[model samples]
Target: MADRDFLLWPFLETRHRDWAEEVEAWAAANAARLSEGDTDEAVRNLTRAMGEAGLLRMAVPESGRLDVRSLCIARETLARHSGLADFAFAMAGLGTGSVTLFGDPALREAWLPAARAGTSLAAFALSEPEAGSDVAALSTTATRESDGHWRIDGSKTWISNGGIAATYAVFARTGEAPGARGLTAFLVPAGTPGLTIAERIEVSAPHPLATLRFEGVRVPDAHRLGAPGEGFKVAMATLDVFRATVGAAALGFARHALDLTVARASGRQLFGGPLFDQQMTQAAIAESAVDVETSALLVYRAAWLKDSGAPRVSREASMAKLHATEAAQRVADRCVQIHGGHGVVRDHPAEKLYREVRALRVYEGASEVQRIIIARAERARAEEAARCKPTP
Candidate 1:
């Protein structure tokens, strides 16, 4: 029961509203299940449950056309109830996104159904020990064999669903050329001969993550996604779609935090009245509300642009992610401030939100990276404008 008012905006349709309701109902019903069990195990259980409940089917629908609005609505609604549940749903789509967009017919037939059904987990392995933000710096290598197989050798870190995934979409240098042009994406199943989970990574909020090693792991050329040199394009295209949804998830966190703040402000007493009676308190709530609305605008605008067949939405997507994530962090901080000392205590909603929102700012693309992207896009636009100007 997070805010439904945002759904009324022009960016959403009746189907979006219906889907949001369905996801919200599903999340509420499964709240207890999502919160129970070991942290890592709980995430797995939730993923399975999401699949069983048919919630994940939309992620890789049979139509093969990804509806960005549906994805954003799903993430926003699930995030309101449980961040872990949101993570489970998101990873299912993200890990398999490259395949959906670029895999050949056989590869898609082999892997996508299992992923959508949650029968098999998936991971995207691109960020390595030395190369995260800079895709060109990745040193993982995939050498060709006489048998037409490829041998992958290197490591990847900060991989989501790393240890538990049944398949990993690994990007390695195939040496077609230097830097980004040389990289290639391969679909390496988890139990392949020379692939191993080197270490599990821990963060403030618990989830299944790890560093993976590829020691001469070999897969048929058939497993390669797209062409030999299209890996970077595949990654970028996938990210363009999901990055907007990341903003939607951040909006969910901010919404929950705002709800908690409002509850506390309306009930708590200070001096002789409710804490919300003060002008200062009113201002903070108003500001948070504005932040939430603006974030939704940016998120859905990018999503809408993509769904309408925009070939590239790098600028809009970056703006949405950058603004929404940073705004969510600020809103979370404000909520904590409004809650007084209770905000810092463990297990509290505000406290949990504080931790959950921090990572969104760093992952996908960091805030700094988003700024750089936005600046570059603006400069390009300006140059084009100047070039098109009439002689004066």
Candidate 2:
């Protein structure tokens, strides 16, 4: 069973606690079946199941308001049971996040309901083969046509829910301004005239990733998200809301590792005693506990700040992602060490966790990128504070 104590923290309200409990119950019952067999089919089935349970509705709230805490709780709880299930749920929010935040009523009516219903899968297409973190360097171009449509030309790689997504929120260079300012987001429905699945990307922990090619795929002007030259802002705003939940997912993985470690240590016998009897084993478990709690605090702090209406939380969110992902990696490593050869064996709980915990540190901004974001934000804050100091 997953840890429920974290939900009692002051960062969460009563409603958040109740929602966490409900999600945990549902995930426990469904995660295993949703996780079985072929990866692609499992993800597709899980997507529909999550929608049927009304969990996907939380991603697009009634008033079109996004509650960051709810997202964090959902990801954390779902991740504790199945990483693939959590990925499906996260993409549902992330893929259509721009529409929820910036799309017009028509776009929302067209996509959001289908996404929430699991009738149509959604994907966010921003990263390209050459441009991953450098949003300004994206070469995907969307040229305005004489017919009041936009013709997109370029390829996007590493797209989540890639081939199966019903629609993609794609970013492209419109040349409306310069660099990042020139980019714009467009809603590209699957099976469009010139769109193709370029290649399927299989990773260590896979859940439907692919490279997409757009050879003059034209979309109606009505499909554009937000104003022209505002794609960067739209993407950032959406990421800012969901990034903290990435940390929550990491926290869940770490907690699961710790639980497995405890069981292994208590039940295994060595030298006429339990494996946990050794001081070294006890110290390792202690460190794992500290790491788990620390990660939880950071994750919830960012989530609470976002929920409380903070305009910008790049620094907090970066810190949370950086610390939680790194800490979870450490916790998983320690659990593997404790499990010895069994940890290295495939299909073992610890072994599976070892692979699942890796991508979090790299995606959603690498650990190095998060450090840069935090340092830059701190330096700016310090400079502002220095400027306001009165001279004696």
Candidate 3:
């Protein structure tokens, strides 16, 4: 019943709206049931349930297919209610995203259905302690043996769904070469010999985040995501898709904040009248509404470009993620300010939103990274245009 029509605009179809509403209803009824007393356990349970309900189907497209719009819509709805809900939905997509884009049939058949059924959980293993954003700094190494097995060593930290994932699409250095060129990806199962959980990281908002140490673990060559040194490409491609959805999540938080602020302001009285009558309060409402609309436009525009068959939405996705996240932080701050006293208190939507929006800006390429990406993309476009001159 909470109106998210503002986010739909021309970017969505009736089908998308219907799907979003259906998922939202499912989440409301089932999320509480899925909460397993502990936060991390709850997320794992939600993943299985979401898969069984067929929600994880959108995570992987049906052969040579991609539904970027569906992914964004699902994320938007999930984040609007609970951050954990959004995490459950996103992991379903990203945990196996590398495989979805590039896996062989055996790989796909073996993993896709389990992920869809929520019987198994998936994870992306790219981030390392040294490689927070500069992925070239990854220390994990994968050396190929004469028997066609790959030995994986080193560790990964700050990994989402880390310890809980039944399977991990892992990236590691393949040689002594520098930068991202030496990297490769492999499918490392949870029970793989010499692999163990290093530590469980306790974040502000509890999720199943951890550090994984892979010591002399062997994975078959068939487990590779792509060819040797394609790990960077795999990692970048995955981030490109997920980064935009980070904006969608931000859009959800903003939508919720705006709703809360509007409700609070309309009823709270001042000067022998409702707060809505005050010029200052009216301006605040106008500003928040504008922020929400502008962010939605950017978020869905990126989704449309990818769904329309445009290859690699780096520029648009970066722009969307940057603007939507920064905008959501602003909107949440304004909501807190508008509420005066109750804003900072926990369980109040605004208070939780404030914490929820913080990680969005920091992770998946920070706002600063997005600005750099946008500028570099523009520079590339200008260079391409100059090369194709009229020859006057």
TM-score per candidate, in order?
A: 0.98, 0.98, 0.95
Sort order, TM-score high to low: 2, 1, 3
When sorted by lDDT, best at the front, the candidate numbers are 2, 1, 3
The all-Cα superposition gives candidate 2 an RMSD in Å to the true structure of 0.9
Superior by TM-score: candidate 1 or candidate 3 = 1
lDDT of 3: 0.87
lDDT of 3 by residue, 59-114 (tens): 86656365778888888887877788888889888988999887888988888888
**lDDT computed for candidate 1:** 0.90
lDDT of all predictions: 0.90, 0.91, 0.87
TM-score, cand. 1: 0.98
lDDT of 2 by residue, 1-392 (tens): 75678888899999998898888888989987789999888888988988888889888655677888899899888888999989998999999899999989988987798789776889999999999988999999999999999999999999999999999999999998999999999989998999999999999987799999999899999999999999999989999998999998998899899999898999989899999999999999999999989998998999899889999999999999999999999989988998999999988889989899999998878899999999999999999999999999
Residue pairs in clash, model 1: none
